[model samples]
Target: MVLAYLLSVIFTQPVVTMEAEAIQPVALRPVANLKAKDTPNDAGQSIDLSWELSPDSARVKRYEVYRAESAKGPFEKIVEFLVPTTAYTDADTLLRNKKDYYYRVDVVGELESRASSEIAGPVQAKPEWFNTNRIPVLVFAVVYGLLLILYIEFAKRDREMFVRRIAGLDAIDEAVGRSTEMGKPILFSFGIGYLTDVATLAALSILRRVARRAAEYETRILVPNYDPIVMTAAQETVKQAFSEAGRPDLYQEGDITFLTADQFGYAAGVNGIMLREKPGTVFLQGVFYAEALILAETAHSVGAIQIAGTNMATQLPFFIAACDYTLIGEELFAASAYLDRDPQLLGSLKSEDIAKLITVGLIVVVSVVGTIGAVLTSVSGESGILRSLTEFFNSGFERLVSFLTTS
Candidate 1:
């Protein structure tokens, strides 16, 4: 009996050891104080969530946020991973203000997570009417507006702000006089642009000056238009110009005619007009495409005094090669200010020119310093005054760029 009892005790001891080994430890610890609210100054499509960190957060590496449309929950994870800052703004609510949203935050670890003891919210989002990020742009716009207004006021006083005389605009009197002396019509077209184009508008401004001269000189002006809208604007422009020149009776309705909208077809009509009329002066200003060379070469063949102005860099070479006088780049844009000498336009033009000169000076200084610095760095690894000057210039340039772009 003693021997049997000892064997049974040994077997029973092994079974009890196996049962103790099978038991495992649980890893979850509940997170606390989860809350959700509407995000401020946002479109009605966002909710802000927050929670307190778990006291047993030793294993917590991230927080996960889950959201559901109802309290009973088929909760879906909204955020994949977030740092434990107890704050998360959910910005994907969409057009769902009428529905309540419930939220849960989980303390996440390597392989598991402990959810918040209670769900966060029945929250709704509201839209803000204004965006604060555009404040910098608005402030700068106001500053520039004030500067423009002051410049205009000063110009009106005839404060004698000298703007450089544009050679192309200056030659206008010579061209118009030649047409008047020859007893022939002057052909004027605003390139092949729609009326909405600013280049076309600028061309129209110069035409106002041209039409007034034609009216005063008792010279005939023929304007062939590619767009109907441009045709209407041109007629009105000429009529007003004639009225201003005290020759509204001389304003001919047939002078400004609408040609086909087809680009090459319009060029053909202008070419035919040039051949038939043999105009003494041809004014081509605005935007042009491939037809620029065609019109310019034809005008040259007609032995006409051609004055052309265009903002298109590609067409500028054609005009320069053919026309007697060509207004390059921004000169075309400033035709009004040059011709009218309107105090407001003149003041703005002078101010802009000054700004451009300043910009050029800064670019030149920065370029020289940078070049010198690079040479010194290549020879002696920036050990001298050249290097120091270069670094100072570079730093100032960087600051200026940052202020302009990022502010």
Candidate 2:
């Protein structure tokens, strides 16, 4: 409006003839040292532009920047309003890495506006493969990986890394011993869950150990499975266990039988076996449903020493009440490692333990710092050094946690 009004007023005060509408233009000093280059540390579709302030910048109202594909006059004004700063970043541009961009700055003064004599050009936006933002996460992954490998090596060397004894796991030998002394069969049941489940797999491993012990004691072992796959796997496990115990002759494929997959029907079948055969030791380890208490209570009434473990939390109280010993939650998952003490298992266990310790330590540190930050923020107001320190700590702590648990 200012430029248009000035032009109309000057041009309208005409003399005559050809010189009637001609008005002389006023001079304005353009910005100096204008430059543009591809932005650093980014997946580039952008460029950074900077320049020395105009000599007439104090007199000038503002400056406008323009961009063009070519070095000539057909430039588009990118800055709709005049910008006060001497520096700007032109991020919205054609992202084809092969294309070059040209930029010029125009200084607007009270009298007239002038374009910079030079334009920065030929700067190409390029993509970067390496993203620097995720360096913390990458660093954490490498460090945590190295730590796990180191602990695994330590375990392989037979170093005693103590894992607290689980009472439920420790009673397996006693249960097998009772079954042997009573001259009754030891019954192991992996409820409806298939061999694909981790809990079921752990149960199978524990069953293998129990079967071996039963073989050594010259005692019979029975595994009534719901899933046909688990039945087959159970037979193999029992066979392998007997073979390992030097009692291949004692292995019986029929003992690890395939019962119905129906939950209550399977429970009814197991209950009947408990009543008829009255196995001295009943092992229930797997996924179960409404039939959990039905089986556990029936076995309880039969005077069997039951050792039960399941991934299902809802059935835990029933097992704890009815069974002699119950492996709860993670104890069920840890059964195989607890029984065998394999270096690989122990290594994984210890590495996970270390990771847990680190996580807990971070949590504690973060909690205390965050609490202090909150209190200081409320009491002393948010503008102090204490608040700043807390803010800094909290941010760093959050980043650390996010990095650790990233994937």
Could you estimate the TM-score for every candidate? 0.63, 0.61
- Backbone collisions counted per model: 0, 0
| Per-residue accuracy of model 2 over 170-281 as CA lDDT, tens digit each | 9999999999999999999999898788889989888998999999999999888899999988999999999999999999888889889888889989999999999999
> What lDDT is reached at residue 248 by model 1?
99
lDDT of 1 by residue, 156-205 (tens): 88898887778899999899999999998999988799988989999999
Model 1, backbone clash pairs (residues 3+ apart or across chains), number? 0
lDDT of each: 0.83, 0.83
